[model samples]
Target: MNKQWFVVYCKSREESRAQLHLQNQGIHSFFPKIRKEKIIRGKRSTVEEALFPSYLFIFVDQEYTNFSKIRSTRGINDFVKFGREIARVSEETIKRLENACHSINDLKADTQSLFKSGDKVEIKSGSFKGLSAIFEAQDGLERSMLLLNILNQENKISFCNKEIKKAES
Candidate 1:
């Protein structure tokens, strides 16, 4: 039987624990994580978090691997499924994820803002799509404030990081 990758749904914040238990059972598993800066009790800290919370991948040949044992593994809830069938991940997808994980892990913590104040940016989506604006400041990890000129008045507006991009000079 050919081996394939399958996703397992784990209890909240238990992906690492599940991965460990799977390894102890001699099962191959992949848990992708990323380093991020977060504020803990008002103090800045660097932490590693699962790229996909509550999920991890396992390599198994269904015919040989004990399904019951895997489902009963510590911290694992069950295999992800589509209705009555277990979900399978493609080898190419796993390879891409592994490559991305390596690149993410190799990156050094950058303190510099992605967009400096006064930098020009363009709204990529939402009602303001295609509009150019001036970057004001980062609102949070996933948001930013921009100065949009409308009717000869500059208005401050908030947008998600994905909704804005650096405008070509």
Candidate 2:
């Protein structure tokens, strides 16, 4: 059976526990995380945590048998719902989201925000890593941008449609 990505709604504050329980049940899963800054009692701190709290992704053969077992598990709130049905994410969407979480872990402070105008930039990571440039313009509302790089004695190249942001100086 082909496995599809399904969203799971873990109990409030029990996402990790649910993940563990599902793992023990031989289910493959993933919970994408990000580092968030919080102030608790006048102290600021950064924490590595889930991007979507109480939500986890599971890859499984979607069947009533599997669904029933999942619903019976401790710490499971419910399957993420869309209308009257469980919401399933496309493999591409899940893959990109997973990449964003992982990528952010290695990100520098200056580059945290997605591409912005007038920011010094570079593709320090991903398929286009090591390409350095300056963000002079954006292509659309999705934060994608066009960048200019100087190479080979003042020659300039413009990335027509690129997803890049400010790079750490």
Query: In lDDT terms, which candidate is top?
Result: 1
Residue 24 lDDT, candidate 1, scale 0-100: 97
The estimated TM-scores of all candidates read 0.64, 0.59
Angstrom error of the Cα, residue 104, model 2: value is: 1.2
Consecutive 10-residue window with the lowest summed lDDT within model 1: 105-114
Off by over 4 Å in 2: 109-169
Candidate 1 per-residue lDDT over residues 28-126, each given as its tens digit: 999999878687898556689999999999999999999989999999999999999999999999999999999977765221356888999999899
lDDT of 2 by residue, 24-75 (tens): 9999888888866566687545677888988989989875346978977888
* lDDT to native, each model: 0.88, 0.71
Q: Clashing residue pairs, candidate 1?
A: none
